[model samples]
Target: MSTWMIYGANGYTGELIARQAVRDGMAPVLAGRNEEAISKLAGELGLESSVFSLDDPATVAEKLQGMELVLHCAGPFSKTSRQMVEGCLTAGAHYLDITGEIGVFEMIHAPETSKRAADKGVVLCPGVGFDVIPTDCTAHKLKELMPNAVSLSLGFSFLAGMSPGTTKTMIEGLSGGSAERKDGKIVPFPMGSKKRTLDFGKGQQPVTAIPWGDVSTAYYTTKIPNITTWIPLSERQIRGARVMSLFAPVLGTKPVQNQLLKWVDRSVKGPDERARENALSYIVGEAKAEDGRTVTVRIKTTNAYTLTALGSLEVVRRMLGRDLPSGSFTPAGLFGSGLVESLEGSGKFEVVE
Candidate 1:
């Protein structure tokens, strides 16, 4: 009976996942660098807590001892994933994180990391949350509808403000530009590579091309050669992204990124339970094959934050109960898009005309 360990158990998304686990009658040990926050949550939930900085690999490895799997919620994962992953590998535990960063997905799926995790016999999965899970699963559904699909597009519209952790993750790569999958390889694109219209059973919405985790995860999940991801935004927002290209050089600077982060920190935190309950997010995936056959799938899920918690917890439960193959994997790659189908609330997907 291996118990789950939730590192970063004090953050917004992390705390949600911890509670979700408890609601399901699972006792997971809480761990993170913030002693006060983790202690308060642990005491409230009557669960054990361990405080350790990711900077200390030895300490991280030690705390992971006897854990079946780790739900890593701490992000700006561009900085923390590697250290935590290293710790997981060394500790012989599975690694699952709620990161939507394309770079982090690429990093974890790199050949070297995949080989190491395979050799260590531990599952290495990233973006098990709202960021990629819904899109990844819809891509999988489209694959079944259009086998041999060569090109895929995913568009999503989230009607919610940024979670503090999510906002920080975005700031971390503010100037990295965008990306797309070409011939099954990740390629860098400028800030606003392209824009298009998507119909999510609702009215039409303008979606702009951006470097989303699906750029990396979908390629591995479906081996699709050409894939693009989009997020719905107003015309003004699209124009804003285009204008950003001109400022890429400046916006990418550490100082500028830091200042932007400070502004975000001062502005707002994340959604509250009511907000999470009220938010509605929609995703559309269109898959096309060389012969011109095409299929489109639309998915609806509730509360981005809540989706992250439920989706991640479900992945953890499966890992504990089943003998999943050890290697770097996206949600669809390991479990197929059906993982989304298993979502409890409004995590529903369907094909549309």
Candidate 2:
């Protein structure tokens, strides 16, 4: 039996991952800083629980011992990834995280940490969420269809609701402003910067180039000269997001952010029959080859969080099942275009070109 550990197992996303793990017939060790929450989740899931805090590296390393893999669901990963990565490396365990924060991605990709993980032969896969997976996987597929692709544009449309963590991450990004690659270098784009329209087959909707996890993932994975990722929203929602962007600096403060997060937590709803039935993500991509030819690919899925867990789970299964080279790697490099087919088995996605 493969022993997996789910850090932050009490979080909204963490619980979902745990539920899926049980459904897949894998016994996962639920762990987090909150002992009560972890115990509750473990009891509910009929799994074992452990206590580990990101603030305490020794405890984190101890908790990670003997685990084949760790599914990290806690975020904002900007605050937690370093310690988690260190602990995973120390324990000789594979590390995966559902982080969409570009700053965190850059931090993990730093020379020192990347080299260390590679040297230790541990896998450090990030952006395991809706942020970059759909886009990154789509980019990989597009590149296969057009190997010389020099630029890529990814757009997403979802009628589904967002998780509290997802909402808070957006608010934080809005408050801090967004950045994107332009002219071969990363440049700051104002919150909600660069607007474009997406034709989702159902209809056309406007999207803005907000700072998202994919900005860095695509760059690291594809080495494409340019990449852009966007999520579509209603005009009213876009306006509201823009307004929130104006206030982000003030609300982004620790106290204000905590207050806002509390409100979000209180109001947010977790996945249920109705919510899962209504959730869906439509991702479309346009890749421009160096020869100036453009190719397009489209992928659609339901229940973003479940699909995310499925994607990460599939990666884990593959890593364990195969004789993969040991090293820190990005999703695109590790799975390449095959991620589409891999995810298809999860019964969550469809691809149309």
Candidate 3:
């Protein structure tokens, strides 16, 4: 019996991770609620699998028994992570998930959650994927360069399509607007409220503030009091986001979400193989001290989904192959900023002071 499992193995991102894990000579148990999809993937990869839903805590815990680690890849994590996290606590299994949701990061990094993970002798690390790994690492690097920094800004430029799960997650949070960290507290703001022009390895482009997970995780990692995240966007897209902000509550309704998700399910197929092969993402981060000193770093990395697969599996391998401490962590908190450059397609950060 394998000690590790990949929940939501049938999901687009989950399947990518599972396949890559197999290619790297690891045999992780594939588990998900979709019996046929899970079974099919398991058979194709020649690995064990379990089928279960997260609706029942007892059932989830029972299924998680004997698992030392579980890579949760299902979403929207707002609805799925709680059950999995609780089950991992009960089963004494270390938990890792590829979540970039600000709320999910805050939930997992809360003091109570950290205490429970410590008591159970398990590590809980979310956002091990594309969501925050690069940005978090870059932020950590900037902190090292400017130890007295009081604020940090992170941004990325990745022109990739979203998976159905990702789309659904966005739909669920449409009403929440965007978020940023101020004085070490997470605060919500209107969508597209802030914008910046940064050179993400490419030319200068306008990036709009987004409710990226770094708004929460970066605070935990760097203790930076103020943090804002951004993504490249066109003027039209910025306007669209502002207009959408007005209807966030309505768009977040159950009926509206259901209808929108139906369209996502029908149309969203994520990036195809060719796109994944050619995908490149650029990340930029700047840390500014109150005394007017600043440090900025930029990174060029692989595709978001590909990087997610690589980052998650790399974390799993290191955790299983060594004696890392048991506690909650941001990806860079446990692994260090070097983790970003250790990946296959990651380039060393170009620092500018």
Candidate 4:
């Protein structure tokens, strides 16, 4: 009987989460800035609705009063996360979002907010979506095997294309260059600076270093001083990254970036159910202890979008089942790989000793 709020409930992924929650016979308050869309979705789902913008942090905080949990599905979370997090803290409601932005990880994990969440005694867990849930779990499992691990590496294969929200977020990161954690410090590198041929058990495929949220979260979760996250990329993508690195100065321009985004419809959604069901994802995490002991773990899961729904809801379900105090946590750090293993279409493969 845990109550939840579905923020950005009309957006592509938010819509999916809302539908799945309803399909599973769970009730969540549907909320967003668009009155017409949220109202339509609320009506369709037979749920209550809230329409408000994050323009005023105080007002946004006021609306969060009494909300037990808020599944923030809106993005670019870079722009949205801080406001909602402040609101969640104000209301003493646990905060969770589907953001994979490195900046976001740094923001929520900031000692200031972390302290606030601790004082409020409400949990602050972001990236509950496919962003880092499975991979965070994978890294956690690897760290367990190599307790003194000083370095953590994680990589994943894309299971599907981006939603409009995701596409927008990617555009925002284009000029920022890629980032990673080195010696407990956030460092930048040129796009695709590191490449590896990882075997996902299927075969060896190319993975190029990318600035994923895990670079930020893993250090917090495991205190691993050095971390790098990678993503499978095609030859064409690797080439494009090189080109982008050279042209970042031009592409970073707001006017130029805005034009690029024009081709993608912000109102347009992500993949449909058929695409989600058919898609597949793979994640591998490796950690090296100071003593040279290393452990690698692999996970195969269903569609990225689909897992976002299933994994996030399962997180909420487990939260409702317990009396978790407020504090910052990664999904796996809080619930462990048991959360990931419990999912129907996901699990860890044999550990690499």
Among all candidates shown, the one with the greatest TM-score: 3
- Candidate 2 vs candidate 4: the TM-score winner is 4
Candidate 2 structure quality by residue, lDDT tens digits, 83-136: 898899999888889888888888777777788888888888887766667778
Estimated TM-score per prediction?
0.96, 0.91, 0.98, 0.96
User: For each candidate, what is the lDDT?
Assistant: 0.87, 0.77, 0.92, 0.86
> What is candidate 4's CA lDDT for residue 296?
80
> How does candidate 3 fare on TM-score?
0.98
Off by over 4 Å in 1: none
Ranking by lDDT: 3, 1, 4, 2
lDDT of 2 at 120: 87
lDDT of 3 by residue, 184-276 (tens): 888899997778788887688988999999999999999999999999899889988999899888988889988999999899999998888
RMSD of model 2 against the true structure: 2.4
Q: What is the lDDT of residue 127 in candidate 3?
A: 93
Once superposed on the true structure, which residue ranges of model 2 sit more than 4 Å away at CA?
A: 235-240, 344-353
Scanning candidate 3 in windows of ten residues, the lowest lDDT window is: 318-327
Q: Among all windows of ten consecutive residues in candidate 1, which has the lowest summed lDDT?
A: 344-353
The predicted structure with the larger TM-score, 2 or 3, is: 3
